[model samples]
Target: MKDRLSAFYWLHETQFAQISSNLITSQRRKAIDIFETEGFPTVRNEDWKYTSLKKLIAPNYVLPSPFASFDEEEQVEYKDIKKFLVNDIDCYQVVFINGRYSSWLSQTTHSKYDICTLGSAWKKYPKIVEENFNKLTKDDGPLVQLNTALAWEGLYVNVPKNIVVEKPIQVLYFTTGSTPVFNQTRSLVILAEGSSAEIIERHHSLTNHETWTNAVDEIQIGSNSSIHWVKLQHDSPQASLTQHSKINQEKDSKAIVHTISTGGKFIRNNLDFSLSGPGAEAHMFGLTLGNDRQLVDHHTRVDHIAPNCSSHETYKGIYDDYSKGVFNGKIYVHTDAQKTAAYQQNNNLILSEKASIDTKPQLEIYADDVKCSHGCTVGQLDEDALFYLRARGIRLKEAKALLMLAFANDAISDIQHPSLRVKLSQLIGRKLGVDMSTVL
Candidate 1:
C-alpha cells in the first residue's frame, strides 16, 4: 500500500495539473484525497468480504504511457486481436490500447450521433463534456476515486433526441506490454429523449504479461429512451479486472445490461442502477463460467427512487476445478416508490468437489404497496438429467458437457444479438472442451 501510494503521489505531483487543467481540478483532487485515505480494499470491508486484492496489490505495476505513433508492431498486434472481435456484426468501433485511444484501429462516426473518445470530446467540446461528465457518478469509493484521478482515455458516446443508432457501438480494450501494467479508464454514454442504442464492450489481452484494469462507466438514459448494453470479459488468465458501472434512467426509459465473464485471474464487478423517474425499468443478467482456481465476484444494486418503477435481475454461474464464484444482489425501494415491482434470482452449478459458491439476494422495500421477491440456489447438475442423456447412448463426458451448456444457455439466450450469441456460445464451448456445433 505504501509503495502504491508513493507512486500515485509522484504521478499527481507531475501530471495532476496538466490533466485537471481543463476539467474540474478540485473534483480530481478530492477524488485522489479519498483514495489516499481509503487505499485498496481488503477482506475487512463488508462489500469486499468475499474477495481480496492482496495479489493484485503486491505486483509493482506502473501506469502505461500513451503511444506516440502507430508502428508496424502495433498493426500486427491489432491483426492478431481481430479474431477475438465480433467480426460478423457491423458496428462503429472504438479501440483502446493500454488505456489510450487508438485511432489507427478504430472506426467512429459523427453524422447521426457522437461516437468518439473522452479525451477528444474534452478537447473539442469542453462545455458539452463538462455538462455530463462526473454528473452521474458522484459517490466516494476507493477504486472509483482512483479511476477518476488517473483515467486518461476511454470511449464517449451520445445519441441525439429521436435518433436510433442502427449499428451497435463496439468498445474494445487490449492490453500489451512486457512488464506488469495497471490501467484506469472511464467511459460515458448519454442518450437523448426518445432515442435508442445498442453497445458492446469487450476486453482482451494480447500478451501473457500481468495486467490490472480498473474501469468506471456512467450511463444516462433519457426520458422514453432505451439502451441495450453487453459486456464480454475474456482476458488472459494473468489479467485482473475491477469494473464499476452506474446507470441512471429517466421517466418511462428502459435499460438492459448483460454480462458474460469467462476468463480472468480475479474479477470483481460492481453494477448499480438508479430508477430516478416514474415508470422507469431495468433488467440485468450475468453468466460466469470459471475453472482452474479463477475467482469471479459480482455485486449489484437497484434503487427504485420513483413510483411505478420496476427491475429484474438474474445471475447464473458454473464453477469447476476448484473455482469460486460469489453473487450479492440488493434491491431498495424508497418510501415514495409505490407500485414498484422488483425481482432477483441467483443460481449456481458446482461441477467439482472443490468448486464453491457464495450467493446472497436481498430486498429492502419501504413502500407499502410494492411487490418484491429475491431467491438464490446453489447445487450440482441433476443426476437424473445426466442419466437421462446417458440412457440415449451419449458418452459420459459429452453428456456432462451438454448438461452444463444447457444450464448456461438460459442466461446466454437473453442476449439480443444473434451473431454475438453465436460467438459467445462457441467461446463457451471451447472453454469447456466440448463441440457445440450441433447444439448451438
Candidate 2:
C-alpha cells in the first residue's frame, strides 16, 4: 500500500503535467509534501485509535476516474418530506448527482446571495478561490489529500454584507454507485459583516452500492454575523464517507453546527471551530444511529484564542447489532483567553451485546479564570424502566420502543426546525424498526 501511494503520486505528476494554474500546482506539491511526511494514519495514532483502515487501503483499490457525465434519471430520489424543510424559510437549493453538479435539479436566482460550482468560481474569481481554497486543512491525511488532488466540481457561496437573507440555502449531494467511486466535494462559504443566514447540507445515496466520498467544507463568518449549519448523511450501507468542516469565527460572531449521521458503512466526521475574536460563541451538536456492521465516528475540536468566548458541545449515539460508534472531542482555551467558558458531553446507548462505543471528551484550559468541563457516558436500556412500562399493560416490544424513543427525545426536540424535528423523529423510529404508535 505504501508503494502504491508513491506510485499514485508519480502517476498524478504525469497526469496533470500541463495544468496551467500556478496556485493549484503549488497546492499539489504541498499535498505531496504532507503525504510524504504523514503518510496514512494507522491504529497506533491517537486520533485513529478506534478505527482501522486495513481494508480501505487494500491493494486492489484505485482512485475513481473523473466523471464528466451521468444520467439524471438514474440518480437517487429523495422525498421532500418534513425533515427536508423547516418553518417558512424558503431556501435556495443546489443538487448534485454522482459527484457531478446538476443545474437542472437545483434552484438558483440572483439576489443578495449567490450559489455556483467551485470550478466556475475558480474560473471567475481565480484570486479569491486560489487564496482560500485548501487553507482550512493543511494536514497531509489521505482523505484530505485525496480530495485536494481530485476535486473538480463543488459549491461556492458568498453572502453580501449587511444583508440578512431571509431564506436558508441547501446543498444536496447524491452519490450514484458505479464502482466504488470517490467524490471529492468542496464548499466555501463567506459571510460578510452584519450578514446572517442558515446553510443545510444533505447527503444521500442513489443506490445501495459500494463507494467512498471525501468532502471538505470551509466557512468564514465576519464580525457581528451568525451562521447556522446543518448536515445530514443517509448513505447506503455499502458506502463509506469522510467529511471535514473548518470554520473561522470573527468578533461577536455566533456559529452553530449540527451533524446527523444515520446510514453508512464507515463514517468519520471531523469538525474544527476556531474563535479568532473576542465575545464569540460556537455550538456543536451531533447524533448517530448505527446498526448492522456500521461504524460512525465524530471528532470535534474548538479553540478559543480570544477572551470572553464560549463554546458548548454535545453528541449522542445509538447502536444495535454489531455496530460501533466513536466520539472524540476537545476544547482548548489559550492562556490569554480569560473568562472563557466551555462544556462538552458525549453519551451512548447500546442495545445488543455485540454493539460497542468509544467516547473521549477532553478539555485543555490554560487560563486560570476560565470555566471548563467534560464528561461521557456509555450504557444500555434500563431494565427496570422497561419492566415498569411492560407491567402497565404495554407489550414487551412496545415498552422497549417507548423507552428508546424517549431516550432520544432530547436530541430530536432540541432541533430548531419544526418540520425537520418531526421528520427526524419519524425516520429515527423507522430506523429502530418500531411502530410509532407504540412509542408515541
Candidate 3:
C-alpha cells in the first residue's frame, strides 16, 4: 500500500513539478519521506490500538483523476446529490465530485468573505494559504503526513475580523465509480478575531464500489469569535473514511463540533482541540449508529494550555448486528492552565448480544485549581421500559426504535441549527429502520 501511494506521489511531482509554495512544497517533500519510511498506522500505535488498518489499506486502490470526467450518461444530477443536503437551509454550497470541484452544483461566495475552494484560494490569496496550510499537522501521524504529501481539492473559508458570515457554508464531496479509489482531501478555515461563522461538511459515495477518503481540516478561531462545525458521515457500505480535524482557539473564542456517523463500512474520526488562549471554550458531540458489520471509532484530545479555559465532550453510540464501536478521549491540563474545567462522557447501547463497544475517557491535570470529570456507560435497552411500551400496544420493533431514538437524541439535542437537527433526526430514523427487523 505504501509503495502504491509513493508511485502516485512520484507521478505527480514528475508530471506537475511544484504544486504549492516553497514552504508547502518542502512540507510535501518531508511528508512523503515520512510516509515512505514508516508507512500507515498500525495496531502497535497506542492511538490506533483498537482499530486496524490492514483491511482498510490492503485494497489495490487507484488515485482518482484530476478531472472527474464522466460519460454523458454517467453525468451527475442535482437530484442525485440533493438527497444528502439539509432541507430548506439557506447556505452557501460547495460541492465536489470524485475529489474534483463541481461548479454547477455549488453556491460559493466572495462578496464579503471568501467561501471557496482551496485551489481558488491558492490562485487568488496565496498568502493566506501559505500561512495556515499544513501548520497544525506538522507533528501529526503518518495518516496526516500522507495527506500533506498529496493534498487535493477541498474548501477554504476566511471570515475577516468582526464580520459575521451572512449564511452557513455547506461542503459536500461525492464519489462515483465502479473501481476502487483512494483520495486525499484537505481544507483550511481561518476566522479572524471577533469574527464568527458556521460550516457543514459531508462525504458520500454514489456507488457500492470501494471508496476510501483520508481527509484533514485545520481551523483557527480568533479571539472573541465562534465557529460551529458539523460533519455528516453517511455513505455506502463499501466506503471507508478516516478523518482528522484540528482546531486552534484564541482568547475568549468558542468552537463546537458535532459528528453524526450513520453508515459506512469503516469510519475513524480523530478530533483535536487546542485552547491556546485564556477563556477559550470547546465543545464536541458525536452520535454513531452501526449495523451490518460496520465499525465506527472516535478519538478526541483537548489541551488546556491556558487558564480559565473549559471543554466538554459527549458521545453516544448504538450498534447492532456484529457491528463495533470505540471511543477514546483525553483532556490534558498544563500547569499554567489554572481554573480549568473539563467534562467528558461516552454512552452506548448494545442492541444485539454479539454487538460491543469499547470506551476509555482519560484526564491528566497538572493545574492545582481545576474541575474535571470523565465517565462511560455500555448496556442494552431497559427491559422494563420496553415492556411498558409493548403493554401500551406498541410493536416490539417500534418500541425498541423509540427507545433507541430517545437515547440517541441526547447527543444531537444541543445542536443550535434547527434545520440540521431536523434533518439528522430524519436520517437517524432511517438508519434505525434497518435494525427494526432484528434489534429485538
Residue 275, candidate 1: C-alpha displacement in angstroms: 0.5
lDDT of 2 by residue, 86-187 (tens): 336567877776667767677764466767777567667777777777887766376677667656667788777887867777887776754555567878
Residue 294 lDDT, candidate 3, scale 0-100: 94
User: Candidate 3: RMSD over Cα atoms?
Assistant: 2.6
**Measured by TM-score, how close is model 3 to the native structure?**
0.96
Model 3, span 305-365: residue lDDT tens: 9999999999999999999999999999999999999999999999898888889987898
lDDT of each: 0.85, 0.76, 0.87
Expressed as tens digits, the lDDT of each residue in 32-102 for candidate 1 is 77887788888999898889889887877857644234434334346677887788899999999888788
Error of 3 at 252 (Å): 0.7
Candidate 2 overall Cα lDDT vs. reference?
0.76
- Using Cα atoms with residue i matched to residue i, what is each candidate's TM-score against the true structure? 0.96, 0.90, 0.96
Compare candidates 2 and 3 on TM-score and give the better one.
3
Clashes of each: 0, 0, 0
Model 3 weakest 10-residue run by lDDT? 65-74
The stretch of ten residues in a row with the least summed lDDT in candidate 2 is: 59-68
